[model samples]
Target: MTAPSVVVLDYGSGNLRSAVRAVERAGARVTLTDDFDAALAADGLLVPGVGAYESCMRGLRAIKGDRIIGRRLAGGRPVLGICVGMQILFARGVEHGVETDGCDEWPGTVERLQAPVVPHMGWNTVEAAPGSQLFAGVEDERFYFVHSYGVREWELVTNDRTAAPLVTWAEHGGDRFVAAVENGPLWATQFHPEKSGDAGAALLHNWVRTLT
Candidate 1:
């Protein structure tokens, strides 16, 4: 069996290297590129982001990464997003009182956490969705989180024709936010699996295994 091919979308994000290395360690033949064709044709596409939501959105749009994600998902191809990459999948994001439109793949808004601390950093445990494939064996393990803004609510409404998404949640300073989401052909995590140690590796392996 061959390792799954993965494209770590390079849209000028600062943390691309770690993501690339992590995915490679997770049994993937990783390529970090902004090339539309390579990104689209890969067995899996990983979108990693850091910094402000607006800046991330601007960089992603500059290379038309948003459209690539949409096109890939429309074809039932797998796309995984991390950190601000995950936030941009929502409908909009309000950072420091200004709101910017997102990719709108999931209908929700990312906003500043209603926590005592702004950036909720450090390792934290997540309540993985019951049927989540990504958290298969690492359901009780902790993952790293470092974000101030996230989707506090998931607003996608599913009908009989569409299956509902599996959502994972995490809390900080009494405010709970979306930690991960497993929707058809689309999976994302608010934390950095690349930095999450052993548990993170298991989660990444779970996802990479799906592609193969």
Candidate 2:
């Protein structure tokens, strides 16, 4: 089978080089681009974001990244988001008492975690949802994380019992937040798979396999 072609969106945010290297290592033909056409036409679209939610969203808007994502998903194409990339998929993001609108693909808000320690850095285990293809072989493994805010609660409602969204969880400082989500063609992880070492590599490989 041919290697999956993946576009690592370069919308002025994210660890682009690391993400590209990781995806390439996962056996995908990776392209780092800010072009809307490249992003929309890729076999897989990987959105990787770093830093604050507001700034990430700004960068996405500047390149019309959100529209590209929305358009891809509407066509039932695969799109993966990492860190703040995952956070901005929701309806809104609240940081420093200010709320910014998100892509609204999912109904929820990304808020600061109610944890004693801010920025839950380092490796952490995730409670993968049952039968999660994204965590198929990495259910018991830990992934690298670096963030201060997350979706503390899930609010998306699905009437189709056969296609309910799978929500994964992880805990830090006694606060459990949405670690990953698999909803049809949309997959996202709050942790950085590009930095999660071997476990991350396996997860990316699993996702790439789905494309083939």
Candidate 3:
């Protein structure tokens, strides 16, 4: 069987190296590139993000990853968006005010945490959706998360109508935020599975297995 080619989109953001290595360790042939052509041709795509959501979206738009992502999704290719990457998949994000400051509304909006602190760091448990392939053989357990802004609502409403599925994995049902979302071939997680130790590896393996 041909090994699945996993394309990791790079846009000069946070520690993507860790993500590259982790995906490789999961038995995928990793290709690190920002080129839209190469990204669109992959068997599966990984959109991992860190730092602020606005900055991440800006870089993504600058490099045209947004278009490539849309094309791939339209073509039915599986995708995994991590961290801030996941936040950008929604309709809008209220993070960092970069999107709001520029007079251009972001697709998703993040809100301030009422928790004791802003950025919710460390490990937190995740409850998978009823039938999530991303959580295959994986129990609902703690994954690494470090962020202040999170997805407020999974289903975005506009013109007095509801939009499509934003993040479809495991929704952070509590007062925290959206943890993950799963929609057919698309899966996104607010937490960094690459930083979740063995469980993270398991998640990566399951993701690759889905592509196969």
Candidate 4:
């Protein structure tokens, strides 16, 4: 069997190398590229984001990454997003009172956390949704998180014709927010699995297993 091919979409996001190395360790043939065709044809696509939401979106747009994501998902291709990468999958995000439209893959607003201390950092446990393959062996493990903004509400409703997406939850300083999401053909995490140590590697491995 061949190792799955994964493209780490490099659209000027910060600290992309760490993600590239992490995914490589997860048993994938990783390629860090901004080429649209390479990203679209990969067995899996890794969208990593850091810094502000608007800036991330700008970089993604410049490389036509949004179109790449839309096309890939339309055909049921696997896409994994990390950090602000996950945040951009929502409808929009508000940071410092500036609102930017996201990929609109899901309906929700990424807003500041109501936590006492902003930018919830460090290891935290997650309530993985039932039947979550991403958390299969790491259900009880803690993952790393460093963010001040997140989707505080779960707004994607499904009909009987479609299975509901599995949503993960985590809390910080008395405020709860989305930690991860497992929608069909699209999986994302607000935390940086690449920096989460052993548990993160396990999670990435699980995601790599689902690639075509």
Candidate 5:
């Protein structure tokens, strides 16, 4: 089989180089592109973001990234979001008492974690949802994280019959937040897989295998 062609979107946020390298190491052909056409045509589109929610959303919008993501999902194409990239997929994000609208792919809000610490930095383990293809063999592993805000709870409705969408969780300072989510062709993680060492590499491999 041909190597999956993956696009690391250049939307002025996140560690584009690290993400591109990691995805390539996962056995996929990678492209770092700002072109909307190239992004839409790839086997997988990776949206990596760092910094505040509003700013990330601004950068994404500036490149018409939100539209690209929405269109990809509507067509059942694969898209992966990391850190703030994942956070911006929700309906809104509240930081410093301000709420900014998001892509609304999922009905929820990305707010500051109710933790004693401000930025929840370092490695953490995630309670992967049952039968999660993304965490299939690495359920006990930890991933690197660096953030202060995340989705504390999942509000999307998923029936028992169709279980394509699964929500994973993690805790820090007594606060539990959405650690990862796998919804149809859309997959996201609050942690940075590119920086998570071996465990992160395994997770990336799992995701890459899902791509055509």
Candidate 6:
């Protein structure tokens, strides 16, 4: 089978070069661009951010990639967000201010991780919920994380997993924050899969598997 095309978003907020390298190394044709049209043309979209949520969203808006990303998600295209990119997947973000009018407010609220520190940087274990395609063979694996804000639990928790409380843990500014979330074809993580070594590569591969 031919490998699918992957587009790693380069909106000037994250290490997109690293993400592109990782995707290419995983046997996918990779394109690093800030162009929304190019992003829409790819088989998969990886939105990676390594800074403030509001700033990342501003960067995305500057290039209209936010529009493209929102449209793609609504259309059922597979889109993945890393770190701050993940927090932007929500409906509102309290990073700097309320996101009353933007893509961040589309899914859920983005809030600071109520942990004991800021920029939760390091490896953290993530256990996949039942029936998540992004975690087909991944039960419990550690991924590198570095962020201060994330999507709240109510946003990603589903009907099937209602009984299972949404538990996302990461530290930021002496408070705990959400770490990961998923809704349909849209999945977000508060970590850097590319920096997670083999397990991270496997995550990219697993994301590609969901393209079909």
Residue 92: error of model 2 in Å? 0.4
Q: Check candidate 5 and list the clashing pairs.
A: none
Instruction: State the lDDT at 177 in candidate 6.
Output: 51
Each prediction's TM-score versus the true structure: 0.98, 0.98, 0.86, 0.99, 0.97, 0.83
lDDT of 2 at 100: 97
Worst 10 residues of 2 by lDDT: 156-165
Model 2's alpha-carbon lDDT is: 0.95
Clashing pairs in 2: none
lDDT of 3: 0.75
Model 3, position 168, has a per-residue lDDT of 34
- RMSD of every prediction: 0.7, 0.9, 3.9, 0.7, 1.1, 3.5
User: How would you order the candidates by lDDT, starting with the best?
Assistant: 2, 4, 5, 1, 3, 6
Instruction: Give stretches of model 5 more than 4 Å off.
Output: 160-164
Tens-place lDDT per residue, model 2, 101-161, is: 9999999999999999998999999999999999998999999999999999999878856
Candidate with more favorable, higher TM-score: 4 or 5: 4
Misplaced by over 4 Å in model 6 are 96-102, 156-177
